[model samples]
Target: MKLNIKPFFIAAVLFFGAFTSGFAQDNLVNSLKLNASEKSKDSFTFTEVINIENTPVKNQGSSGTCWSYSANSFLESEMMRNGKKPVELSQIFSARNAYLEKARMYVRMHGAVALGEGGQFHDVINMYRKYGAVPQSVYTGLNYGTDKNKFAEMSAVLDGMLETIVKNPNGKLTPNWDKAYAAVLDTYLGAYPANFTWNGKNYTPETFAKEVVGVNPDDYVELSSFKEYPYYSKFVLLVPDNWAFDQVYNVKINELTETIDNALKNGYTVAWAGDVSEKYFSWKNGVAFVPNKDFDEMTVQEKAELFNGPKEEAVVTEDMRQIAFDNYSTQDDHGMHIVGLAKDQNGKEYYIIKNSWGTTNDYKGYMYMTKEYVKYKTTAIMVNKKAVPAGLAKKLKF
Candidate 1:
């Protein structure tokens, strides 16, 4: 089923940065706190229509590593769905491994690649397939005299080192530069363990990943919807954080939404990447929606109603979504897990999203995102290939 939406003139909303690091969370929380009075006026209520069992919310404190946290959480849910014991996998292990690889690429490209705390869902899967994973208890990535993940000082030092290397001061690059870089990572994020014991058994990262985690990296597929790309074909998502340049299968907007609905109905969760900078995205109230009226045109009551409950949403069209992408309004900003479905007081549907910002929001680290918001702001989603409908899977070549 295709949506025949048409574009119309609407007041523009300001664009914000895409990456959700530890600093960004602090700012978001502060902003929400300041708007407490406005949010308190709302009267929104949600009834859960579907809920998937998953692990507790985690805090990626002082780190820009939501990509790893959300992907690992999704894998934990997959394990539960598969009848395996749910384990809190180490997010930093993957982050550390990916960081090293990314640093290598940055230097190889003469510092042209983006280097920081942003990544795609595919990064976690690729890291698992290559370096394997460890339980969070096994590796917390807190080696720098702190109990939480913090990378500010470490990031500056690494960036400086890379910049110096890119300059080629000696006219001939040193073969041990990679070793030097690895040393810095090891000093901060801790060295990768060659082997470790868990549950009274000894295993290497590879064996543990295969025998215990038991997730097939290939079993998952990343999908997106954009009018510029041919339907049923793959294209590289042009996001800066996608340093690895992963390809996503492009489908019509309706097919993308239908796939998400089908996945949740079948007890599967999704890893979502999208923009969260809209005027109606109220993290404090635990609601995100695309209101029908423009921000400037809305009356005080209408603005309050937006957060209090579901309301009529703007008609999001292919051109509108594409324009947002083209003009840098819809950014690849944050990564989250969509675990369930909910309906507002008026029976409008919303995806129950699990965030990695700890339990601070009205829903305790979870938010209800309206279908219109998802349709308009989404960058992409990663889902278990089996969860996709047979028809859509065929189109995706899965």
Candidate 2:
């Protein structure tokens, strides 16, 4: 069925600003920070290798709109990279647009499309292109008096409305249904702006996006690696959150990891969609790596001391990655941004990933993932076409 291709994934990424000589993350790295591994005498030490300037960290809170949050975060960096002043884009504004669009599709497809809080990263860019963009200061989506995003009640009410509309109790759909659905969004997320003045200039969403945001929606591209398809081809990524069924370019695993390294080194940040549910992913500790020892085979002592220090990572291969992906071991559960690169004492590489779960982790809402871990777990990544290496860009025909 055309509607059966949904992947129930939720992405939760934030920004990772530059970590130069005096940047906060670099300073912390210099201190040899130890998070959960404090119990272990020997802890891991990280040194910044490559970093990019970006906007501040944000919280998705109790919502599953990390796709909007992460994509906005990456676009903020892209604006900075393009020499424009940084501004926080409204993540929920894009999400609000997506919700209505998703609703239209769900009803059109007889509820075959999944309806929930989760979404994929590309949805942000697509929404921006279609509905234009807005500033967070212009629309906060906090009408319920909460300081942060909490969507339980609103989502439940919206889902109930969608269920009724899909059932077509009247035996036929009416035009009023769409208007009624939009009213619920306005009641909860607040009425959106038709026009607003910013920095002494009056602008609408479209004008603001063109005059200030200055991002070429076409400049960015999404890519993934899967042995199921021929390398350098493109296919629809099968994930529940990919409700739009957008196709992503396919490449070898080595090329996939190299693309990120090349982007970080060349003043670009990436939006990551992947699985972080492995025994080794520790968001609280702000450390993630593919350990040589498998969790299932490890003894209690080994499991307890997993983060004691740098250890050998699994030699991730294209075949192994495909196996895990096929068996459901690797899932598209969460999403984040790859803002920089770091190296441990053992010289193993880690991607400096920033999460949208607030500034709560050891790195202050920032975390690290081994390149091996990323290669093994990443479902897909979005980056500027220019950020891709000249040779690889030609190969992928980006």
Candidate 3:
């Protein structure tokens, strides 16, 4: 007999601009460049170690759709790397299509599936393989008349409608429910085009994706590292945003870093997903690190040194990573593109992250994440399967 699963509300995983008081101060300090002098004891001196080519930064703007933006950015970079002319694929094209499909899954599961603006990196691949893609000019998803996305009312109305349908007051679902759902999406996000002209040629979304995007969705893989799962094997990433239940290859923490490094070294950029709620993750300073001391416990000098100088970092272990995951300290909160690497004055290495929250940070929508912070806080990452070393790729059976 089939078992019934009940749906319950969890806190939504949307990224907003609400930052803590400490984070606010960090932002102010970063804005003032209070420690920017080369010789200042309170300044961080960084040199670019490795920088990869990528598309320009774009803002997500009042929307919880960084996954779409970052994944699309990754695809755009992939197209450029493949010798194709760069074109900005619409993030909302993927997001809009994914939403409709997710609604169907939620309804099919009798509302047991999680539904929100949050999604995993694989959601883009899945959407691309199914509905195909369009350029940003073709499907802007801004039918509601705002230049940027604001989905509070839309999310509420959609959730309420799905919940009502799941209740099944009439004991049978109507045939038009899907149409009704589509109508709501079309009203807010604009109707997806059946065919459009691009670059003086008439093309459908699939044709545009094939001839223009020029990247194989199947060539990418999502990977993660945790002690709970066997190394070099696949496991479902346990996160609320992973409502699709996508499986990622699990590797040792060191191997995970090696894979990332190898990928970047081999001219590939990574789609990075991790927790950004830690105090050490400074959006304003455009830097993230694993501090030896907690923010509250640090002296004023130590706090200044956080931005201007380097300190000893805790050695992150697989067990430490697993405990954070099991205890909810590590969460899949945001997604960004890992496009390059940098070194601080003390020669500590950091990964260059391209964020989608607009060009507000010190680096103008980019941040430098410490290697320690990445090892400690990352939930999962996506890279081109070819970027993986041949031996590891063979083991993963990619």
Off by over 4 Å in 3: 1-13, 16-42
Predicted candidate 2 versus true structure: per-residue lDDT over 160-229, tens digit per residue: 8999998999998998998899999999899977799888899898889999999989998998999889
Each model's lDDT comes to 0.80, 0.78, 0.78
Q: Which pairs, if any, clash in model 1?
A: 18-333, 43-308, 44-308
Off by over 4 Å in 1: 1-22, 32-42
**Against the hidden true structure, what lDDT does model 1 obtain?**
0.80
Tell me, by TM-score, which candidate is best.
1
Clashing pairs in 2: 6-240, 7-239, 7-240, 7-241, 8-240, 11-335
Better of 2 and 3 by lDDT: 3
Where model 2 places Cα greater than 4 Å from the true spot, the runs are 1-42
Our tally of clashes for model 1 stands at: 3
* TM-score, cand. 1: 0.92
Structural similarity to truth (TM-score) of each candidate: 0.92, 0.90, 0.90
lDDT of 1 by residue, 1-398 (tens): 00011121121111112232335455545544532335442567778999999999998776777788999999999999999999999999988888888888888888887767678899999999999989998888999899777777887788789889999999989999989998998898888777889899998888889999999999998999999989999999887777888899998887878989999999999998887666677767778878778877988866555665456788788898999989867777678899999987789899999988788778899989988888898999999999999998887777
Q: Number of the top candidate by lDDT?
A: 1
